[model samples]
Target: QDVFPSKGGSGTGASATRTDPVHELTPELRRARERLLPVIESLPGPIDWAVAYGSGVIHQANAAPSSPLQSPPMTDFLLSTPSPTQFHTSNIRSNPSHYPLYARLLGGSAVAWLQDRWGAGIWYVSMVRVHDLEVKYGVISTERLKRDLEEWETLYVAGRLHKPVLPLLTPPPLLPSLHANLLSALSLSLLLLPPRFTEHTLYITIAGLSYSGDPRMSVPGAENPDKVKNIVAGPGNLRGFRRLYGGLLDRIPGVRWEDGKVAEKGWIGFNGGDGGEGEDGEGWIVQPSSPAYLADLIPSLAPRLREGIAAHYRAAPPNDFGSGRGTEAGAGAGAGAGGTRRPYGSPVYHDIAFWERVVKDPQFRTVVRQELRKIMYRPALTQSVKGLFTAGLTKSVRYSLAKIGKWWKARQARSAV
Candidate 1:
């Protein structure tokens, strides 16, 4: 498979760019959004940008009938401002009760300090009720928002944005950044995915990045293992996912679509140096990356990656990215478990000699996985801890008990199985 195209596609083949989340709204979605108007309107301080996410948005978009047992899931907001300290300062006066007693006593600067310095780059105020609807809003500086989106440094807010998020208050200048950040996310996720995967699996992999190695997952039913899958597979969500990711999808060289789903054709790289094309000379499969492919790819991926990758590409082996040790036999043209003739090449292998040396290194994939995990794990654990405090005593206790109960049930079910 040719991971690197000779030319970059404009990312808009025949389809138009879908930049505005408003375009996705249906009557049902609109009505559902209406219910949160009070919550949105009640935000106390200035916001550079704010997005509404979580089960609340999904429920609204799906317009499922409400259940009395579940007071509509909290309308969650990931908000950004020019200055979190200033915003919180102003907001503290307007909504004093939203702050925990300690946060209030310490002041907004202290809250912001704790948020950015100790927890993830957000200070959340949960269980704030407005017009009979519960809401949880997290505030962060626009700087942190952009940094995380570009670098995946935290993968906290970026992960939430990966799923469908209703952009409520977007500044015009930030629109392009939002679009690019999402594309970068898709590109990174694609790199991490196994060569063979279904469309839904692709989204699941992306969604799962945020939760990778999260300790909460070990706590029985602390998190629904199916949460990511459900988000991607839910009504209207897959369409939303495609709309958000379609432009970037159009740019990938050999993505094959069938029955409205997409996957790599088969194998990667060329058998007999033929470039993975069939007799018809149409369609390409997902393959290992070549050095040249990686050369092109590093630049094409998120900007933060370019610096670390460029030197590796230039040196051509025996370095950080393992561009130094495998052979043509090791990197290309191998038999699969199913007895299929598969090219056994690194996803980024351009030179045969380089592949020969690099493949021997063995730590290449591990290094990449470790780097990605490090970005996600700490932030997730910090957020989990922060949630206990931000949720307040009553809400925190209730939430914890609910999680414990769910965990117990899941444990029991597993034992029964």
Candidate 2:
């Protein structure tokens, strides 16, 4: 009979024999794997073995119609052992020269730099550890990968990953060490604004300013205001700003702020409405008259705006600006029960609102959304599966399963004998 084994019944020997153990490896894939093998072999610790998996292991002579081969086949390495830390440390120590490349590939150096600069070194490293591995090994779904890649590309364009080695990777690292200050300023701006207006143009403007260090910070009139204006208002400036804003916002959580007086004020500020002053009351007058206000209109405001922008770029810590869960009551109390009932009215809030308006502008929105869509669905875009695994490395999972099958086959042979 062609019947399969029932639940509690032993399957025929065919079932066991049908399982295949070996996987074919292509020449290019084999070469890539070989290159990484030495790196893995040098890893210290009690690792029993290492292997490659996925398309790297599939071994195809030519690219399928669906997946064209533009570059060398990428391979993901899985080191089998009990301790992950020891393995990772050994892996890095085994090849320090390659560590920068790994950092570049995994998007960790920017994270590390931000953490160190912002006094949140521990949190930044922790985020790097979590996100880098996940991004490296295809641990996330395709949709999520698209989102992350979009954000990374934005950061790259904004000059966030200006450090060495990062540009070598296809997508490049999000928020590199050199551009942490710019990223931080952009983050602060996002925190200050509503979600809808947060666009790439605003963030890029901030990034450009930070890079130039306008000197308007400690020294008034130290730099040319025209230069700053040129950078912020030049052609394609808006697009750059949008990416910077989007990238920064992606890193923050619960970005949606409550609608109220502060939200309204923030909205007005964002909409270029002179922040609701109308020549009366103490509101954030967009077109200010005071010398300080004129100085601040760009320069003074730039520094304050940068504070919030930078905070957002750095992935605002839970306790930052009293943003943690428990601090809600305290923040509310500090704002006073009857005091305007606004969203966190810090300078960052104002900057965020301004950028949000720029992003939401119909013309700007249409262009950016189109660009983002194009980036999202680009057919030739290649992501490294090796760098995509966070929760579990694919190679490790396949290797374990293969070993189990091999062991089972040996046991079946012994029983038959």
Candidate 3:
């Protein structure tokens, strides 16, 4: 459970920077932070951050209305460690059942190698029964986690974090990065969403970032189709959604809220005016203007977040109309006071029109969809491989049958259509 190397120093371990503002503890949040944190903290590893997500956490979120004895699906944790290989090497010895026989025997170095080389920067262990909770967890280096969350390099962890999660352990210094990641996810999702949409639809679009092109989606029940709607529909969850996006929404130009929800006329539009060239004079050539209210909300973001958005446009180039096409590389650029060409990229902070251009580009949307599909397929393939190693013959048989049945039904439905 004590994952950080030290409790006192600033050398990548939990330090003074990790402190959160004191809050009047609510029973729910107290149980999550106080009770659950101890359980995760007790797990053997050097953890920089750990969060419990998926249906198990959702059940916990909804537990106020349900019986405590009710069984939920396996609790899931996504852990960030300073060094995954070292963490897995030690973790396997303490919690051998958490990993497959091969992974345990091969040692932590192999675990780390496989995660980085073959899998997304994380390795997974499933079917772990710990502290009376059935759990599955994925481990990755803290550096890689932050990178993906910011740049969305794989959209694996990025997609997962887009949804609501209960953070059992987050050191104080890492808090800002986590919040920034969520903001980046929202911005990226907005870039893919239609110009006009409802809050529920907006959350749905955000949630869909993970599942957009997943191959498992071919089988209707492989992933819940109604997941996005459900995540934002329930009052408890809706509140969580609002907590995540509310302030950000309030600052977006042309986004209006009435009575704590998005109003009908809350259509997002860009104000075309000359602003500063992107942070570096080489990223995006021109910057989009923002209202005073919206500008105040911008936060410093990861360089890759801005760079990734720029990459999409830089590939196709944009016209003067901001259509994100044509060979006019200087289309969005504004001349410097010195009248020199300043090739700008997306700002490392908020750029509403930059994101809006991304959203409006058909080619960009296609690329996003393709990348999303890749991310989705990897999990399906990884889970199946892991299942063969970890699951009993009977459980595997039943799972295969269920998948077949679901797939057949889906095929039949399509045939009828």
Candidate 4:
């Protein structure tokens, strides 16, 4: 049996040998993929990953058109490449009109620089029409995307992956960290949520994570107030959520499904095989109260998040401190040469007492929320500002005004009631 069924693209020396895996899409999702294939394959040579996600691709009921005059939502894509400069060069050469006049004037090197050196390490090319379909896409280097996933360096790409997406191509190299990103989201959601929550609640929390502390989300005309609820409200989207995360939930220990197991077998996940045994119903998942059990949760978090939690404990100096190799007296503690703090790097799971205090504190959830805000807020706002430039003023205004219209309508409806 072939380990990787297809080696896509005539990659340059670096991308020549790829072990791209196959995805089993649902009928609706498969059609989405089929519609997007031409656009995907037509892109500049090799890409690390290609995925379609957003309200457009998932089609939530609340986001549907209210009148015949409404245009279909543009399908959004996130593409990862080994080399952004090379990819941009090829893309701009082929699709010069896709970018704004200013971006086109800047050239590929400048565009890639703005992307890599700027907020959240992504570059956008929006509102392109291809193959009779309206499309918008963003590009980030594979390494940067992997860091965002594994390190939570920025939740930009990582957050988008939390919800359902139609992945056109996800090669072996990016799968592990991508799965780690999902696992981290679950661990955080379970940590923050009540001891018992329905599957809908879990999905809702995960979907809203990227939006938490997002400055744009606070602005009335910037986003859909019900975006998170709408994301997971419909049956189609709920099924998409199951396909994305059910496998991981099934493998977690000590979680009891109250109604029905959401994960069905044979969904492609981190293991690249079936999701193992699972049932077919939306259910309430119960998490245990054990601090020891909770400590395991902390370890799987992205390093940045894990460090934040650990720093909080160290600062407060729990009674159980110094049990697992105390910092020397007058030592820099966990600080580096420049007086910046880094992770203490000790295995945290062994510090059961530390976790006991962490989990038991009434403020634990609050601390996690604040830490998430620190990780998420700035990048989201900065990226939104960046989008204004990348998407061009006309498109940006059109997008913002559309959202404002939606916001106004929703507010007026509430007022009338």
Candidate 5:
């Protein structure tokens, strides 16, 4: 959207001749402004016009109360609508092929702009400005806005961006948290596995055989087929392993399985199996470059790692390593015709029950939040976390601005008082 309006429209030509000195914003605000401006400029099509909006503008009325710790707020921009519409229409009409590029450019511009300049705080204001301008200027259709909002909401829920409602809050510590949780779940699952059938050695062996030379499988003795099988085939143990896998899939961005190994490229793979024929077999492999690898690198996994371990347990003979029988019937059945049998006093049953309890338990949610914070805030995880945050933050600016309008106004009121 253009920040400048065209001549001869209702209030479009109105320009404030008055000039105020460009007051220095708090470092945070300054950073936000610096980041957002270029994005605005680079947005697909020229910015017809843009104006300052929200607390960035209102907070200017009086200097914020001096605080030793809190930083001053940043400036907000009110991008005009006609510019966006013209840009979109021109791009689509001129080269429909570029429509996707135009959208991508729009999204990228917003993201890059925010990443470089604004903190999460300014996102809300930006959204409000866009919404207000679109409604008032009739630039973007309501249908389009709704669709955009849906996409934005999906990103927020997936922890892709700082939540629009709480932009000031840091992005969700997904990778670290997932890592911790997966480990915990695994431990719990192992604890629950039936002792008679449970074999840590076997599990380690199987995993090792499967992973072999892959950096992700670098854990000592992880290659032993017996050890890996025990870990995989043992009672509740597999539950924890699956949870670990699933958690990795969720938290690690750009994770993909290639050449039978987990690797991170840019996003995580929700499913196993990279869809390639390997000399070894045809199961999904975890990619090493993925954020999940970080967990593997960590000294310990989270405590909740075991909670869901029971859910993945299989009651079957240990011989079904790659029989492909489980592939069609699912992993729950044991090898042989009688189906998997459970050993007496098997902790597998208990682990399964425990997992059930954990899923329904609210306490697990608290644990998740705690672990997430630990993993996300760690210095080592900063780069990937920042990348994910940047991806989400860009999409958030517009919507956050709309959602936080009232909050900004309230803050302005408090400052005024």
Candidate 6:
């Protein structure tokens, strides 16, 4: 499949040219990768990519002075493979201990089915001892991962990629999709955010997208309540966010950073929209990056998307949108310039003329939140159910207990404060 599939964009004004991001390992990330070298090497052949992520791996952006001193080493990894069936087949044979007895008996076909078809399209093994370290890892198909990245189909792995990662075995082919994922996160976050906000706020929004409607987050002690803040609060974490998204922010149309308030040492600010220099603003602009972003992101709410597209398309005149239909022909055809007149109910995915107007709907953000909940809620619940089998009841219990304990500690700490 093409790495960065085109979304049928009409490149008009400054075409926010984007490319694959280069991930240079920090000292901590380098150490972490080196630690996981054995596991990386031992994995089955033809693995598309593998990366080490999670709290134990790195400082997680810029850590504020007030933040906790050190995090326990986390050995969380995501492996993207072309053939999950083959990969699982080999893994089950090599490390039968990784899966429960039922999973092994069900065979690779069944396990792969669950991973692809169920809960956010991922299968994870927890509390795994790789060499001297206890590691947890998730497996996903390259296609499924790509879909989540490009289509926001699940926002599972895509949300994880929104933050920086330690690339143990990344290849060039996957870069475009990775960068596009970040851009998508940015586009959605800008839509959800207030007119003006801090860079921390932007990163927070991006980081929280996956968990927004996720039951794992809502249930008491299932997840750390401060998970979002922890991921985004520190200067180290903020710095990571900056490295991943700073250049992309510049590429976004009608966005500019505030005066000197944007600091390289982990501080960033920008005014809302293309507003003038001296107005009450947090710093960055929140416009819909581009027509393509607006066009591409509307699919979650397809009916609304179609309605918006059709309405926007019909409102414009023929010549106005380069529809090629003269005034009279367009009226007769009931199509807008640059838009094909579909029957009463046809999906209009890529009409630039329509996106210009569709994004401006007063209820865009509110409706987006509703649609996103509809898209995310069920998968989040189902994935946790799948975890009982994928990770095994024992491992799931252990992991959940560990998470609950962590949440309790955080709650106590916050309460004491």
Best by TM-score: 4
| TM-score: model 2 vs. ground truth | 0.21
lDDT of 4 by residue, 1-417 (tens): 222111243223232122322254566667877788678778874576778887778777556563688778878999887777788788889998878888788888888999898788898887888887788889888888889999898889999888877777666656678789988998898888887887678888999888896898889889777778777874477666766676677677877665442343343322222443233324567878787777768877887877666666556544544544433321232332223465536544335555666676677888888888888888888888898888888888887887898778767756777
Any idea how many clashes model 5 has?
Answer: 80
Candidate 1 local Cα displacement, residue 249, angstroms: 0.3
Query: Number of clashing residue pairs in every model?
Result: 30, 41, 11, 0, 80, 15
Q: Which portions of model 5 show Cα errors greater than 4 Å? A: 1-38, 42-160, 165-355, 360-363, 379-417
Please report the candidate that would top lDDT against the real structure. Answer: 4
Residue 78 of model 2: what lDDT?
Answer: 32
Q: Point out where model 6 deviates above 4 Å.
A: 1-21, 60-73, 260-347
Q: What is the lDDT of residue 175 in candidate 1?
A: 58
lDDT of 6 by residue, 1-417 (tens): 112121111111122222333354445555666777677567553466677777766454222223377435547888777788888898899888889999899988898998888898899888878786788888888788777776667677877888767676555556777777777677677767765566667878988877887878878899888888887754355546666777777666555554444544233343121211232223454454554556555443223223433444354432335444222233322343455554434434444445554465555566566656665788788888988888778788888888888789778878998
Residue-level lDDT for 359 in candidate 3: 44
Q: TM-score for every candidate vs. truth?
A: 0.72, 0.21, 0.68, 0.85, 0.19, 0.75
Q: What are the Cα lDDT values of the candidates? A: 0.58, 0.30, 0.54, 0.72, 0.31, 0.64
> Candidate 1 or 4, higher TM-score?
4
Deviation (Å) of 283 in candidate 2: 22
Q: Which residue segments of model 2 deviate by more than 4 Å? A: 1-183, 193-201, 208-222, 247-417
| Candidate 3, run of 10 with poorest lDDT | 276-285
lDDT at residue 65 of model 2 (Cα atoms) = 29
TM-score (C-alpha) between model 4 and the true structure:
0.85
**TM-score (C-alpha) between model 5 and the true structure:** 0.19
Sort the candidates on lDDT, descending order: 4, 6, 1, 3, 5, 2
The C-alpha local distance difference test score for the whole of candidate 6 amounts to 0.64
Those runs of model 4 whose alpha carbons end farther than 4 Å from true positions after fitting are: 1-22, 65-68, 259-282, 318-340, 343-345, 348-353, 412-417
**lDDT score at residue 219, model 4, on the 0-100 scale:** 94
